[model samples]
Target: MVSKKVTVKNPTGLHLRPAGILCNEAMKYQSQITFVYDGGMANAKSVLSVLGACVKCGNEIELTCEGVDEQEALDHLVAAIDSGLGE
Candidate 1:
C-alpha cells in the first residue's frame, strides 16, 4: 500500500467536472485508489463517492493505493491532485 497527503487546489473543489476527472484517472490503474477526507473515506474511481466527500479547496486528503501498481498509482494521483486535477 502507498499513500500521500495532498491538498485539493481547484477552486470548486471535487465537484462534477473535477471529480469526474479524478475518477477517470483512477480508473486507469488496477490498484485500489481511495482517499480519506473529513473523517470519511472515498473511492477515487467513483465520481459519486468523491463528490460525496465534499472535499473543499484547501482541504487535505490522504490518497491511498494498494495493489500490483500501487506506487505508480499513488504517484500519478498525487501529481494529478498537485496539478489541480485539471481545474
Candidate 2:
C-alpha cells in the first residue's frame, strides 16, 4: 500500500467534475484506491463517494492505494490532485 497526503488547491474543491476525473483515473488500475478527508473515507473509483466526502479547498486528504499497481495509481492520482484536477 502507498499513500499521499495533499491539500486540495482547486477553488471549488473536489466537486463532480474533478471527482469524475479522479474516478476515471482510478478505474485504470487494479489497485484499491481510497481517499480520506475529515475522518471520512471514500472509494476513489466512485465519483459520488468522492463528492460526498465534502472535501473543500485547503482541506487535507489522504489518498491510498493497495494492490499490484499501487505505486502507479498513487502517482497518477496524486499528480491529478496536485494539478487541481486540471481545473
Candidate 3:
C-alpha cells in the first residue's frame, strides 16, 4: 500500500465535477483507492463517497492505494488532484 497527502487546489474544491474526474481516474486502476480528510475516509472510485468527504478548497487529503498497482494508482490520483482535475 502507498499513501500521500495532497491539497485540493481547485477553487471550488472537490465538488461533483472534479470528484467525478477523480472517480474516473481511480477506475483506471485495479488498486483499491481511498481519500482521507479530517477523520473521514471515502472511496475514491465512488463519486458519492468523495462528495460525502466534504472536502473544500485548500483541504489536505490523504490518498491511499493498495493492491497490485498501488504505486501507479497513487501517482495517477495524486497527479489528477494536483492538476485540479483539469478545472
Q: What is every candidate's alpha-carbon RMSD to the true fold?
A: 0.6, 0.7, 0.6
How far out, in Å, is residue 52 in model 3?
0.7
Q: Candidate 3's error at 45, in angstroms?
A: 0.5
Cα lDDT tens digits for candidate 3, 22-73: 9999999999999789978999999999999989999999999999999999
For residues 27-76, write the lDDT of model 1, one tens digit per residue. Answer: 99999999999979999999899999999999999999999999999999
lDDT of 2 by residue, 1-87 (tens): 999898999899989998898899999999999988897899999988998998989999999999999999999889988998879
Show where candidate 3 strays beyond 4 Å: none
Model 1 stretches with alpha carbons more than 4 Å out: none
Instruction: Assess candidate 3 and give its lDDT.
Output: 0.93
Counting clashing residue pairs in each candidate, in order, gives 0, 0, 0
Q: Give the whole-model CA lDDT for all candidates, comma-separated.
A: 0.93, 0.92, 0.93
**Candidate closer to the true structure by TM-score (higher is better), 1 or 2:** 1
**Residue pairs that clash (backbone atoms under 3 angstroms), model 3:** none
Compared with the true structure, the alpha-carbon lDDT of candidate 2 equals 0.92
TM-score, candidate 3, is 0.97
